[model samples]
Target: MQRFPFRFAPAYRLPALLFGVTPGTARVEVDDTELRARFGPWSLRTPLTNVASVERTGGFQFLKTAGPAHLSFADHGVTFATNGDDAVCVCFHEPVRVLDPTGRLRHPGATFTVADPPALLAALEDLEER
Candidate 1:
């Protein structure tokens, strides 16, 4: 299994603690069959095959992606962020439900502020080649 911890900015750490999101609690883990994430109380799980693509991105507005999971109003993408710096956006073949409780609202992509963006991206890419 490949695991990546979330990057916690010094300024954001205190706020994250309130949501029960610490470095130990927020992480993304990938095994042969599944990709699982735990960000405080929110979690996202999907089959490895469901992953379509991954890209590195940044420049986040604090209000939009500071603490818990945030859903994009424009794209319906969910962001599991701890910091505003580096993040990897993973697009899925099929949209997954998150942010909404009814299970009707699904997101086509998810962005994670993992500690190592390149490593996480490379890991997913290597899985694709296998």
Candidate 2:
């Protein structure tokens, strides 16, 4: 498994801990067949084939992505954010379960504040080539 860790901003480090999200526990792992993500109490797992696309993004709004996993009211997308800086947005071909406890609600995409967006993107891109 290839693991890509999340980046915790200096300010976000403490706040993220409130949700049990620390540098040690938060990361995204990818393999030949599947992808897995862990953000303390939250997680997102799906087949690598489900990934539709990946793009680098940054400059997150604090209120929208401060701690834990955030759900967008407008887009219904889930965000597992740690910092407001560099990150990658992973879009899925089919919506997947994320925030809804009952597993009724699903998200079209997920954004993560990984330490190295390029590496993450490259990894995802490689999956597409295969």
Candidate 3:
């Protein structure tokens, strides 16, 4: 049994809820958090170790996570891995993107290859608007 500690602000609750995920599901204690999220039908879980925090700016909230690592979004039905240091990966359902630290698009369309936090934040902003 493995336990991962994560902190999600109240703002993100809506997005999680929209995806049919409650706090209980988000804050789960399981053997493999990533695996559980991947196999689960309607849940999106990222390893706490991979995630840093959610950044909010200009009426938008973004889920930010460190990249160069594997990630899964069951609701979005996407699974992919990144390999970059200052890369930030953003997954809004099926659409996933990666950005560099300066907030420039490293990779767009289909798959992402960078992991910059600023880029991730930008994507989050876009999602928040939707």
For each candidate, what is the lDDT?
0.90, 0.90, 0.31
TM-score (all chains, Cα) for each model: 0.95, 0.96, 0.28
lDDT of candidate model 3 versus the reference: 0.31
Q: Considering only N, C-alpha and C atoms within 3 Å, which residue pairs clash in candidate 1?
A: none
Q: Residues 97-119, candidate 3: write the lDDT tens digits.
A: 32223433222211222223454
The deviation in Å at residue 5 for candidate 1 is 0.5
Strongest candidate by TM-score: 2
Report the lDDT tens digits of candidate 2 across residue range 32-100: 998899888888999999999999988998877887899988889899999998889999999888788
Q: What TM-score number comes out for model 3?
A: 0.28
Which stretch of 10 consecutive residues in model 3 shows the poorest summed lDDT?
106-115
Model 3 stretches with alpha carbons more than 4 Å out? 27-35, 38-130
> For residues 15-85, could you state the per-residue lDDT of candidate 1 as single tens digits?
78888889888999999999899889888999999999999998887877877788998999999988898
Which has the better lDDT: candidate 1, or candidate 3?
1
Runs in model 2 deviating more than 4 A are: none
